[model samples]
Target chain A: MLKRTPLFEKHVAAGARMVEFGGWEMPVQYSGIIDEHNAVRQSVGLFDISHMGRLMVRGPQAEEFLQHVVTCDVSAIPLGQSNYGLLCRPDGGIVDDIFIYHLPDEFLVVINASNREKDWQWLHDHTEGFDVEIVSRSDRWAMLAVQGPGAEALLIQAEESGAGSLHDLPFHGVALSSIFGYTALVARTGYTGEDGFELFFDAVHAEEIWDKLVGLGAKPCGLGARDSLRFEPCLALYGHEINDDINPYEARLGWVVKLDKGDFVGREALVAIKAAGPSRRLTGFEMVGKGVARGDYPVHTLDGEPIGVVTTGMPAPSIGRPLGIAYVPTSLSAEGSEFDILIREKPVRARAIKMPFYKPRYKK
Target chain B: MSHNVPAELRYSKSDEWVRVEGDELVIGITDFAQDQLGDIVYLELPKVGQVIAPGEPFGVIESVKASSDLYAPVGGEVVAVNGDLDASQEAINTAPYGAGWLIRVRPSGDEEEGIMDAAGYAAFCEDRAH
Candidate 1:
């Protein structure tokens, strides 16, 4: 049986094309992916991201435990700040990528929905000697992502009914707010690379908040648009781009790994890999011809020798061109390097390019 | 749903449809499928004269949103392939049941199986909608 979110009825009423995503029956699109993607790019869109996992770690040892578990230094983070980090296995493989937010009394970690159970168990198993309590808040809360250029304006209107004004929140910041007469945790963070707010509220109040946002001109978006939008921004998806078999260095996420912060789960492996260097590196590519490069497509040299494989690919709606990310040998991973994508046993020319095929227009 | 599903064509559960044209069976994705996929941007059509087995992937169609495999509805030898999709790929999104026809194949002497008639295809879509 598939799990259902609080907004399941809302999605049905909106004519959403439903798909089973990570054990939850969620909308893949409503009006359409392109339409919803464009809506979030130009205006505002609301997404039922309650499927994403949320965990709270609270105690006198909260900051100290997080500093030891995650690769990033959570000790220096002031209250209301959030930092992107990764949980790595002992051998440097990524367990899961997460965002750690520092609240006054506790640290909140938002992780991928698919990895929620695994991550929760991993955290518990590793916390045997620690004094912190690792609690899963996913079932108790519902999340709504309000994203786009006009997100703040729409959120302000929704927050008028006791929801706090979102005006003071900055990027990567979190605050307590009220909406629809319910207290909620409002964070100015998003995966779409757009200025937006992710609201964590009581699961029962999700429908009312969803309707209110829709009534305020926030188009209801789905996983389809969410994928395209995040793809355009080069944000990494766990299963597609990063996984347990791949480490942070190979995924080009070395910035999120802090080896100097002392021993962590994967510190030794990351340190050795950092010293010797990664054999294969993840890089971006653009199809020079008229074909779409998809995942698992062979990356080959001009002479037809296999080099690597594409990890993620799509026709970017924001750029109006075909783009993808691939894992290529270090020698050929440089920007402007030329390669070919083997499509149907035929070589299609592709050029290695810098990531973030689309630059976001964040509010100043 | 003004989109038309011609009575002469046969459709597979995967949304591919086949119609007899001269000595070959012409195949394309259904109009309903195109409408759901939205804005066909690129097509990976199979090469001419390739042998394809039933339910095997012959090509892929990628839109701005997702990628879907184009499967062979019946085992056959590819006699012809759609080359026009290389340039004006929107033909699939605009007229999927017609100009978007993906390939033509000579049957491997087997009777058509697992195909739905026009009325059956419409009902199949209706069943999926619920």
Candidate 2:
């Protein structure tokens, strides 16, 4: 049996297409994938990201414990700031990519829903000596993301309890603001390439806040749009772009690894891996001939020799073209490199292209 | 939601509709099939004069969400192909019966081996609606 988010009732009432995702019954689309996708790119869209695992790290050695496990430098971030990081194994394989926010009394960590139990076990096993408390708030809190080019404009109209301007908040900044008569954690962070705010609040107020946002011309988007929205920005989706066998170097996520920060879980193995140079890299390509390259499809060189597997592939709604992200040999991970994606046993022509298929519309 | 299964035509279990026009037969995905495959973006149609085996996949149809093989409902030779779908395929979602008709075929063998009328096809669809 699959679990459901707090807004499950509201989603059903809206006639959404519900599907099982990450062990949860989630909406795959409402109006449609293309419609919701265009909403995020053109105006603003809202998403029920409550399926993400929400964890809290408190106690005296909270900062030290986080620094020791994550690849990013947690000590560098001040209160009310968030940093994107990754949890890796001792062998430098990615466990899961995460976003950690430095709060006043505790640090909030957001992780993938499917990896919630495994992540908890990994984090718990590592806290043998540190005086830190790992608390789970997965069920008590609900997360909503309002993203797009006009995100700020749409969110600025929301009922607020703060006196300062939201535009003043820096990217990756966090604030405790009163919304809908309750204090909610509003973070200037998101997975989509657009400028957006992630609102974390009590699960009971899920429908109230979601309704208000949707009533304010914010399109209700689902996981389908979420996946496509992140793709145009080249954002990595765990289990797709990165896995237990893929490292930061090969996944084009080396920027999140702060090897000089301190002694971390994967620091030693990452140093060795970086020194040895990556054998293959995640490369982007566009279909030069025909057919959409689906996931797990074999990619081959022009000579028809199988090379690697496609991680994510589809017709990008924003770019209006069929694009794909795949792991290719180091020799083939170059611009203008030619390859073939076997779509239903037929070799279709493709060529390596620059990533972020469409130019990201991020606020400066 | 109920699907639109024309009473005048026949349907296959794979959700393809066949319209008998004198001697030639018109083929296209049914409304249920198009609804199942939302927002089609690309389509690979069998060429004119190509041979189609009964119940065998003859071409490919893909939406933004997923893809599926277009299995022939009857054993025949492709007489015409909808070339317009190669450039724009949204008609499959908007008009699965008219403009979205995929191919026209000249029958070669028994065409009623596994096909069903509108009433039988509607009940067949009802049984699969979980």
Candidate 3:
């Protein structure tokens, strides 16, 4: 049985097409993927991201425990700041990509829904020696992201809490603000590569806040638009881009892995992997011929030799072109390299290109 | 929501509609199919004079969500193709039965006899939607 979010009935009433995603019956589209995607790019769009796991880690050893588990330097971030990081297995394979928010008393680790249980177990197994309390707030808290070029304006207009100027909040900053008569955690972070705010509040206020935002001319978007928006920015999905077998180095996320930081999970293996150099690297490619190269499609060389596999492929709605991310041999990872994506057992012409297929227009 | 099924047209189980004009038949995907496909960006149509077998794939239509094969409702030689779709594929979503017509074929067999009529096709679509 698939779980439903707090806004399930709201989505159905809005004529949204619901599909099972990450063990949850989520809305894939409301007013069509293209329209919702365009709304996020040109105006503002809202999303129900309540399915994401929220873990609260508190205690004296909180920062120390987090630094040991995550690849990013969590200790470097001050209070009310967030940093994107990755959790890895001892074998250097990614466990999951996460965003950690540093609050006044505790750290909030937001993770992908599909990896919630596995990540909790991984973190639990490593907490034998640390004096920390990891509490799962997955059911108690609901998340909503208001994203796009005009996101700040919509948020400020919709916020009824008399909160101070939200524009003053720097990127990746977080604040405890009163919204809709409830205390809400507003973070200047999002996966859409646009200027946005992710609001976290009690699950009971989910519908009220969502309705307030929508009433302010914010388009209600779904998972379909979320995927397209993130894809254009070349953001990695957990299972597709950084699974248990795909390391961060090969995923072009070496910057997140602080090898210089003293001792962490997967540190030794990553050092060895880095020294050996990744044999296969994830690269972006654009379809020069026809057809969308979907996930798991075989990528072949110009001479018909199979080199790599496509991770995520789709028509980039923002760019108005078909683009994909694939893992190919390091020799073929350069831009302008020609290759073929086997769609329906037939090789289709494609060429390697720079990623972030569409340049994100984020407000700095 | 209910789909639009014209009373004069015959339909295939794959959501394609066939309109017979004497010996020639005009083929296009139904409004239901286009709505399901959503935002079609490209259409691959068979060439004029190309012979197609009944129920055989004549071309492919791609949307941002999925790619669907455009099958021939009946065996025939393609006499006309809608080249306008090459420039504006949104016709499939806007005017699927008219401007979005995929191909015109001269029948070589009585394949239309096995197809469902308007009422039967509407029932079929309603059943599948549930």
Candidate 4:
């Protein structure tokens, strides 16, 4: 059986093409992927991301426990701020990539929908000695992401419908706010590389909030648009780009690993890998030919020798070109290096390029 | 939702439509399949003159979301291919049952026994719907 979110009926009414995504029956799109993707890129779109996991950790040992578990330093972040990080196994393999938000005495961790159960269990198993309360709040909240260039204006319009104006909210910041008479947590964060806000509210009130956002000119987007939008920005999806077999260093997420913090789950392995350097590195590529390079597609060197595999790829909605990310050998991971992507058993030429295939227009 | 399956056209379980042209069987994905796939970006087709077996993958259709294989509706020799897909792949989404005709095959014999008609395809789709 597939799980349904609070907005399942809303999706059905909107004529959404639903699919089973990570155990939850969710909308892949309503109108279309390109249409919804362009809507989010040029205007505003709302996404029901309530399937993602949310957990709250509190107590005197919350900070200590988090710092010892995640790759990013949790002690430095001030209240209302959020930082992206990764939770790793003892051998430096990534358990899950997540975002940690500091809120007063508690810390909230947002994780991928597919990795929720695994992450929750890992956290529990590792918290044997920590003086903190590890509570999973996945079911209590519903998340709506308003993303695009005009995201702020649409969100403000929705806010005026019930919630107060949020004009002073800083980027990557979080605050308690209200929408449609319901108290919600409003965070200025998103995966689409656009200026947006993620609103977390009671699950029961999700439909009302979603309808209000849609009525305010925010198109209801789905996982299809979400994937294209994030792909354009080179945003990593947990399963596609990173997994238990790959470590942070190989995934080019070493920047989040703070070895100086000491004794994290994967500290020793990360330290050794950092010293030895990564053998293979994640790099971005643009198809120079006609075909779209997708996940598991073989990436070959100039002489047609296979070097790596594409982790994610798609025709970028923003740039209107085929782009993908792959884990290539360190020697060939540099920008401007050319490679061949095997599409339909034929080698299509592609070049390694810098990330954020399309530049974001975020307000600094 | 339309239930407007035209009676003249033949359909496959995979949502492909067939129109008999002389001895050739012209094949194209149905409107329902294109609608489900959203915008079609690339269509990888089998080479002309290649022999295909029924239910065998002869090509792939890539959309913005994912790639799905295009199966041969009937066993035959590929007589013609849609070369226009190389440039205007979006035609599949716009006119799937018409200009998007992927391939034409000369069947080895008259073997339309397992294929579904338009009404049957509609029922098939309805049965598969969530």
Candidate 5:
């Protein structure tokens, strides 16, 4: 049986179409993709993100252990802040993209649901000498994302939280607080390209907070809208954009690879990768022809020579046009460079465009 | 099971529906098919005057998350297409039987042999559930 989140019942009650994703039965959509997607873009929306792995790393050598395992400069992260980082193999291939939240006592490492077991095992394999303990907080917490332009006002209107005026919380900042009388770790971070907050609270209170948020006009959105929201901003999705065979540089995630921080896993290979420059680059494109670009579609040159493959291609709801991301040779990845995407054996014309098809609306 | 399967129309196990009108066969994907592929955003149809074969793909449907083949239940020469769908494919989700119709075909006579009644298709769709 596929695993269900704490809010699974809520999703079913609202008539969401359930689908299997990352070994869990998740709600793909409720009120339809376009409607929910526009809801988040134009107003506030709520999402159940409990299916992701929630973990805590603590002990005397916790910081050192993380600094060695992840590519980010973990030592630089102050308490109440988080850093987006990646776990890489010795060959610099990406294991997963993670968010490391530096709390007062422990570090909260949020990982993808599909990579949860593998990431946990990877962490354990590296704990030979480090005086640290890795604890799975998945069962203890239910995660929710309150996102969009109006999210701040909704949070401010809510009662009883030590975070004290969400407007004061810096981007990527976390605060241990009480929300609606329940202890929660509220973080000003989200995957959507908008101002939002992710709350980690007790699993038992899933319905309580979810209902309250919905009552307060936060439209209940599902995975379909969530994927579209992230797609517009070109945020890297694991398994599609990044995988064990793809390095951070190839995935356009080199910014997260802090090599100067000294000797993390894959540091040797990443240093070489950065020096030599990546052979292929991840680039964005807009379809000029009449076909919707689908993932895994083969890409060919105008002369019919196959060059690369598409990672993600679709009609973006926000952009009002068909856009996609693909890994092509660095030579053909520049702006105005044209390629042919073979859709059903017919090559459709596409032109490489500047990345981040849509600008993010995060609070600066 | 709640999907609308009109009894007057014939269905193919591949989820396409056939409605015979005079010498022409009006075809569209079934409601069950639209539901299977949620929120159809794009539909690619064969050009008018093009020939098609039964059980072969004559079009493609791209939903929000997936892209699937739209097969021909009864093949013929394409005479007309729902061109307005090029801008808005959501009609396939909202009105799968009417405006969602893909192509109007001048039947090739030998193409309707393998189709089933609505009850048989509903049963087939139910069987796949388990």
Candidate 6:
């Protein structure tokens, strides 16, 4: 049986098309993908991201335990801030990409929904010596993301409903505030290229907050729009971009791997991989041909020899063109490098382009 | 939950609709198909003179989220292609039965053999939806 988020009923009531995603029955689209996607780019949009896994770790060695597990420097993030990082196997292959939020006495790690059980097991297996407690709090909160250019303005309207002013929260900043008479955690972070905030509150209040936000003109976007919105920004999706066999470096996420952060899982292997240089690099490309390239579509040399496969491919709504990401030989990963994407047994022309496919407007 | 199923058109199990104008058959996907596909961005159809076998795929339609094959309801020779869809595939979404017509085909005389009429197709769609 698939799991359903707290807002599942609301989505159904709003006539959203539900699909199975990450083992959860989630809304894939409400209005439509293109309209909802463009709404986030031009105005503001709302999303239900409650299916993500939220795990809490707290103890004297909370920071120490995370340092050993994550690829980034956990100690560098000051209290009330979050940092993007990765968890990798000892072979340097990615386990999961995550967001770590630093609190006063505890650290909250947010992981992909599909990797919730795997990550929890991986974290537990590596915690034989650490004195920290890790607990899954997935059902405790329903997470909502209000993103795009007018996100702040839409959120501020809820101030009369007991929500605190979000005018001062910097990007990647977190704070405990109240929303609709319930205490919640509001963070200035988003997955889209637009400026926005993510709110985590009790599950029971999902409908109230969602309806209130929608009433304020925040378009109710779904997972369909979310995928397109993130695609243009080149935000990595777990199964598509990074996987247990694809290392962070080859996925073009090497910047998040802090090699200087001392001893950590995958650190040694990553050091060796870095010295050897990545054999293949992930790159953004636009279809010079007529068809839209899709995931697992083969990328080939002009002469028809297969080199790599598309990781994420779609018609980028914001870019107003068909674009995608793929792993190609490091020599062919440069901008303007021409290649072909095999769509339905025919190779379509494409050219490597600079990422992100769309420029971001993240607030400082 | 109701779809616009015109009472005069013929339908295929794959959700394509065919309109007979004498020996010529004009075909396009149903409103339900376009609704399910969501935001049609691209359409690829057979050439004007190409032959299509019954139940065979003649083209592909892609939305932002999915790609589906356009299946032929009956064996026919293509007469006309909706060239306007090359520039604006959204026509398939907004005007599915009219401007969104995909191809015109001269049927092989068995176009009505296995296809369903408006009422039967509507029932099929209703059954599948449930």
Q: TM-score per candidate, in order?
A: 0.87, 0.97, 0.97, 0.91, 0.96, 0.97
Clashing pairs in 6: none
Q: Each model's C-alpha lDDT? A: 0.87, 0.90, 0.90, 0.87, 0.90, 0.91
Task: Return the interface RMSD of the candidates, in order shown, one decimal each.
Answer: 1.5, 0.9, 1.1, 1.0, 1.0, 0.5
Taking the tens digit of each residue's C-alpha lDDT, what string does model 4 give over B1-130? 6544667888877777888888789988988888878898767788989998887778888898788888777889998999988889888888887777899999976444568987788888888763
Q: What's the C-alpha lDDT at position A109 in model 2? A: 99
Clashing pairs in 1: A163-A178
* Fnat of all models, as shown: 0.78, 0.39, 0.39, 0.78, 0.56, 0.78
**Model 1, B21-116: lDDT tens per residue?**
777888899988898787787777778879988888888888876678888888789888888887888888778877888888999855346688
DockQ of each candidate, alpha-carbon based: 0.59, 0.67, 0.65, 0.70, 0.67, 0.85
Best by lDDT: 6
TM-score (C-alpha) between model 5 and the true structure: 0.96
**Candidate 2, residue A31: CA error in Å?**
1.1
Winner on DockQ between 3 and 6 is: 6
- Give candidate 1 regions above 4 Å deviation: A161-164, B1-4, B8-28, B44-60, B69-116, B124-130
Best by DockQ: 6
Number of the top TM-score candidate: 3
DockQ value of candidate 6: 0.85
**TM-score per candidate for chain A alone:** 0.97, 0.98, 0.98, 0.96, 0.98, 0.98
Displacement of the residue A241 alpha carbon in candidate 1, Å: 1.6
Comparing candidate 2 with candidate 5, which one achieves the higher TM-score? 2
User: How many steric clashes does model 2 contain?
Assistant: 0
lDDT for predicted candidate 6 compared with the true structure: 0.91
lDDT of 2 by residue, A1-364 (tens): 9999999999999988888898999999888889899988889999999999999999999999999999999999989999999999999999999999999989999999989999999999899789999999889999999998788877777748445456777899998877767778888899788888999999999999999999888999989889988888899999999999999999998889999998999999999989987899999999999899988999998889999999999888888888999999989999999899999998999999998787766665
Ranking by DockQ: 6, 4, 5, 2, 3, 1
